[model samples]
Target chain A: MRDEAALMRSARFRAEREQDWIKLEALVAKAERGGVQSLQFAEARDLASFYRQATTSLAIAREISLDKALLEYLEALAARAYLIVYAPQERLGGLIGRFFAASGPQAMRRSALFVAAGFLCMALGGLTGFLLYLESNDWYYVFMPSGLAAGRGPDASTEFLRSVIYDDSPAATGLGAFAAYLFSHNTRIAIFVFGLGVFACLPAILLTFYNGLIFGAFYALHVERGLGWDLGGWLSVHGVTELSAICIACGAGVQLGSAVLFPGQNTRKEALRLAGRDAVKLAIIAALMLFVAALLEGFARQLIQDAGARYLIGWGVGALWLAWFLLGGRSRR
Target chain B: MSLSRTRPTPNRQHRRNRRAARKKAASRVIPPEGVPLELPVASLGVRVAAQLTDLLITFAAAVSILILLSMLFFMYWSTVFALGALLFFFIRVPYYILSELVWNGQTLGKKLMKIKVVAHDGGSLTTHSLVLRNMMKEAEVFLPGTLLLTLDQTAPWAVWASLAWVAMAFAIPLSNPHRMRLGDMLAGTHVIRLPVPILLKDLAIEAPRAISANGQRFTFLPHQLDHYGGFELQTLEKLLRAQENRMSQSSAEQNRQAMTAIVERIRQKIGYADAVEPDDELVFLQAFYSAQRAHLEQRQLFGDRRANKFYADARPRGTG
Candidate 1:
């Protein structure tokens, strides 16, 4: 008789709760197949309530030593329900808006010290490269690759140097292609620099300095031809944005390296995780900046030949970026 | 359900214990209500398979786009090349991030593999986490992969550097219990295998009909039922369910032989003298299973909980 009673008790227990489990399972299945958007308002509310009830049933089942199969089913149901209920709800539009309005600029501001360090490294390298080139023109070949130098080396005549900067035919014919190529290439380099930052920031620093060396060498070649002022205007049209984007990318990488090297209060892993949040934001913003730079390089530099106007547009954009980074998301915070 | 307790040989018992031990380790996350839930981490092999599937899909898509663009802009080869580069990045990068975002951490490949990314802290899987993890994939997998493919063009020192980087990246996942790659560790996320829910009918209901169908009903006394516990009963329940599943003629013959062996062993353990007919083997087992389960449930209420048949010997000397 006792055996029969025990059997009946378990059977009754399952009978009482089976309906809820089946309902919850159906809801979970629908959500999995079609996402939370498929659910009606009432049905979504039902899902949450059913999830809580299932969790309670799981707890009860464990305490009372219900049949093993029933207990396992309840556990699985509860876990699935928990994941669905707690999933992030922000839409893509909202996420992108939030990033621009607050997260992106805020992250950049937070990592200013690292960005400064990155800039210092690049500037110092530029000085060293300029001085070496001044000492002797042999350093020019060491710094600039043949393909990149494009026949406008120290030996190039003044007229040739001027013609290269003032050239606008390529922009008319394939400006779109040029911009796309520059965007993709610069973005790849920026991302690569950010990624390699995991190895103690040394690689990022060296790469940034190397880039500065090439720029310095190129500038010295133009200066030798008495085209320094003209070249500055041509480059300033896009270089300000492009170089700053690279600097930001390097800073982001340095953030990761320092997080690993000196984790401070947190464990190394924890520090790296925290730093990744800000570093990713910085990296993304840097990529966007590179896109702008690419556009400027491909079109504005080609169309606008006036040196003074190019400087105005270039530094004007730079100043605007600085102000935006400083104040864009402060109100939201 | 057979009350005739089958004693597995020592070798089989050891193997079973080891199998149980090899079950995937679960990560515990505490929900808002404070109940800790165990989510099973996906195995390394499954994760690799899912990644390969995703990579193949992206590569195929990128190639198709490239071909279409080249065909449309045959006159402008440079434009086609530039567009192709942009298209590949768009397809590859957003394919991962957007798919995971929309599907709540599952891409097509992850969905096919029945795995998903979940937050380590049991919170919602935020957009930042998803993007961060996928971005790191470029560094961890794609960059090293491209380096390896272009090894002939690279300097010898570069080859060694990339090789070391790849090894370190691979070793990180292997060293961790959760098999978390660099992205997962940084993003505070890990992939988990979704459980396949089993909806078998209650085993208790199979007892009465099976017992009544046989001319000689197999019955067990209380003491005979006391030898085993809930764990053994559940294992028997699984075996019975497996037997009910349709199989080929050869497998059916093998199944019958295995059941006969179990019946013989069970009878020996319980010291039952009566011979159970061959056709009634399943019926006898079902009857024994229900009786043993009921007996275990009653003892459990009295705080004399037995985990398995081995519990009797494992108990303290005084308790036995």
Candidate 2:
């Protein structure tokens, strides 16, 4: 007799609640098939209410020790509902606004120390390369790739170097291809530097310093031929943006490496994850900077010839970047 | 209703038990509501297959884009080539990051495979994590992959270095229980197999009948029902559910034989003497299942819960 009562209680429980379960299942299935947006306002509300009810039922089922199958079904339903309902709902427009106005600059500012370290490494590498090139002209061949040198080497005449830097002939037609190539190539290198930072940050530092050596050696070659001022004007127009972007990428990589190496109180994995948040934001902003640099390198540098105007524009952009990082995303008090 | 009752060999039963234990060891994620939910981690094989599907898609997209560009801008082939190269180089990066972002952690391949990435902390999937994880893929997969393609031209030490990197990348996932690659480990994300919701009808409604084709009802006394427990009831329920689904004639024959063996074993254990007709085997099992379930639930109410037939206190009551 007691057995019969227990059986009837369970049956009645299911009979009373099964309809809601079926309804919730249908709503969840629809959402899964055609995203959460497909649901009407009423249906979405219904989904939330049903999800709560299902969770309650799951709790009750555990208390009463209902059959295993019913408990499993309820658990699955509640989990699916939780994931769908709690998913991040910010639209793309809002996300973009938040990224630029807050996350991007704020993340770059937060990692200022690492960025400084990155800058220091590059500067020391530049000094070393400059001194080495001055000591022996053959260091130019070692530091700059022949292809990238493009006939501007220690042996190239000062007039030829000036012509190369101030050349305005290939401005409109071939600049597009040049810009595309530089954007893709430099972005690839930046991403590579960032990714390889996981191996204790040495590789990231080495790559950044190697790039600096190339820059310093090339500049020294022009300084040797008395075309240093012209080359500086030509390169700075884009180098200010491009080199800073690469430094940012290197800093992000170092952040990852340091997180792994010195994972304070948290586990190494957790530290790496926390660091990745800011590092990735820095990486994205760096990529954007690279895009701007690519445009300036391909078009603006070719069109502009005055050394004074070039320095003004390059340093002006640099100052703007500095201001943006320092003050872009501070919350209003 | 006695028949030959051959039990499964102990070794086979042990192996089956181990497999079930492994299946039951799904990871639990606790939601904000304080309820812990079980989510099964995807198998390495399925993850690999999904990755292959994604790679094939990206490769096909890049090749088609190249061909289309070459055809349209034949006169400006140089510019087209550079633009095409940029598109080809960057397509996979955005394809992964944006698809995961827009689809809520599912790429087209992951959706097809019915798997998705979820945060290890049970929070919403963040855009930062998605970007970070996919960025690491450049190091984990593409870098070594490109190196291997140019192995014939590279030095011996470079070949070894690339090979070591490839092996390390492959081994990271295998080393972890969740099968997380380097990116997943760093991003605090893991992939999970989605559950398929199956709604089985209430079994309590299948009360014993008064009459059947055999001209009598199969009834179980209280002592007979006490021979099993809730775990056995669940196993019986699964078998019955499987029987309900349509199957080929050969499998149907095998199912019938399996049911006969089960019926024979129950009779022996409960000492039931009534003869159940061969055609009425399923009816007898169903009647026995509901009765056993009711007995277990009543015991559970009195705080004398029996986990399975193997529970020491749940030994047959004087062999019925």
Candidate 3:
């Protein structure tokens, strides 16, 4: 028969080479199932060499081979090898823990200058707003929109103002609903301050300034009404963490902006990606702080009306946060 | 001599002149470092489906809580009210967060839809991005809709402001190449289509038994089978597949020519002495395919790949 010698030649090729292919196949199977570490060093080396040879054979087989089955097998095998060789996605929790414990603080420390800059802008704005509001009560209207101010301007009755600052009662709409709204509002502001840093940090700086302006205008209103002490107690209960979180967020944003504005060696995109990672870590920490701040505001501020007690709680919470950032998760050994 | 040695040199006299000349020419565009050329942005239909699924899920949870809270309120009004406050504020955001976290960037809805959220760097998802993007949904989507629905005589400015925000939310995606939502842009994330592989009918039908008319098959010795590599094998497989479904006469003719040309090229390259009948072309390729595949796979185990066979063999190694 015409196909008899061709069959003999095919049979002979298999007889000679089939053993090694079988060996390599077994090794790959064992490695995939138990991990490549299961192999001894020499065995692992063999796998690598076998992979290269398999890659070559795949090419040669393509040129003239008639076995569709063999080609498919090699194709799948090579893909598995490729995955083991190249893709290195790590466990998500490990990465998250790694970020929080070390990289987050490291990044925060590196952006100290930006933090100072944000604080300065906020402080200046607060001072300006305070000075103007003192000159004329109408300046509160100029600084804060009517909607945001919630008629807390000069026209608001003292009783209404007192209720807002020391409203020991559960929020009319349910404390949770109010807290949720406030948290969402705070989160949105932080994200914008961070995200808009791509525009050369101008928007972030201005937003930080505006935040301080509102704070200053609010403080001035309370001070004018002879309720400045009450407002301080109320704000202090959450302000230590809440305001710091905002400042930290703005700092992170400015850092991201600077990556674009002063990318020295990397392309702007690469610089942004690198800075974005750092900024995101800071934002995560800030978001966590805001959660804690909301907790204090919801429970402590609602229960405590004494100025001394509120101040004590506020300072205590602030100290805990400061210590955590500086010292938590540090290695002893 | 090699072709380059025979070619005439260019006439630029100085390095500066050559540089200037090159500068005068049209610039070639290269992709900036981080951007990848090809990624399939999820279509709007699938995105909407995923979103609706998530909305339904969130709504169900909220309703379940509402029912429970109502029961609790009947039992103890004051205590339940306080508990309700805490739950209402806390539940919604964490639902999104915990799902994304545990699922590794897939919510239950996203899993059902076979899509995933990925950080733009195509790395693991971060808590900050998930939080930021979801919080933005409150500002950009929910809050506006709530205000519009709740207030009968909302300030004209408030209505316009809400409308402008909603417009921005919808408009940003349409304006961009990535079709990214506003939240995605802010968080540097994307909803990507994750295509799970589907099965196909097996192409590996058994090789037929056919006698060569010449009483001989073109015998390819082992060494001669080393001309091509895996890349070529893939090409050959593709060609065979392309011929697999040639039901139409027109396509069948094209396939026949392609098969004939490929067989002839292999015959010439390997110096197979026997003449292969055109009618037996398929059988010839099939026989060669089996032998060559076997030979290549064996070579792979030995660390002797074609194209790089010489380079591999040249590496210094200790005899073990």
Highest lDDT: which candidate?
1
Q: List, residue by residue over A65-107, the lDDT tens digit for candidate 3.
A: 4345554555555434432332223555776687777767776
Preferred candidate (DockQ higher): 1 or 3: 1
Query: Which model, 2 or 3, shows the larger DockQ?
Result: 2
Task: Supply DockQ values for each candidate.
Answer: 0.40, 0.39, 0.09
Q: Per-residue alpha-carbon lDDT of model 1 for A1-333, expressed as tens digits?
A: 244533545656777888888999999999989999999999999999999998888777665653777777877888898889988777889889999998899998999999988788779778888888888999998887564677988888888899988885654435545546474435555766787888899988887887788888888878877889999999899889988998899999999999999999998888999999999888888888888898888778888888999999999999988998999789743
Kindly list the per-residue Cα lDDT of model 3 for residues B1-320, writing each as its tens digit: 48675544455346656654543331111112221212345655787788778877776676678677676555345444444444543566677767775555667787788766666654445666676567656545766665565334636765775677677777777665456675676576776565322222222234454346666654568868877665566567566556566368887888788888988899898888777788889878866765565576567656665543253465469953
Model 1 lDDT at residue B298 = 67
Sort the predicted structures by TM-score, highest score first.
1, 2, 3
Instruction: Candidate 2: list runs displaced more than 4 Å.
Output: A1-9, A63-68, A137-147, A150-163, A168-176, A183-185, B1-26, B48-78, B89-98, B131-170, B207-231, B302-305, B313-320
Task: Give the candidate order by descending lDDT.
Answer: 1, 2, 3
Q: Which residue segments of model 1 deviate by more than 4 Å? A: A1-10, A63-68, A145-147, A152-159, A171-176, A183-185, B1-24, B48-75, B143-171, B209-219, B229-231, B298-305, B312-320
Q: Model 3's chain B TM-score?
A: 0.52
Judge candidate 3 at residue B42 and give its lDDT.
Answer: 62
Tens digits of lDDT, candidate 2, A102-166: 98888988999988877877887788888899999998888776656789887888888888887
- List model 2 lDDT by residue over B1-320, tens digit each: 24677777899989999866765554677677776777888888898888888888987898798787667655365565566555655788889988888888888889889888888888888776787788777778876676566345525754676678778888988876677888898788988888777767766674445346858866778888777767788899888778769999999899889989998999999999987788888878877777777677777777767888877665568864
Q: Which of 1 and 2 is ahead in DockQ? A: 1
Better of 1 and 2 by TM-score: 1
**lDDT score, candidate 1:** 0.81
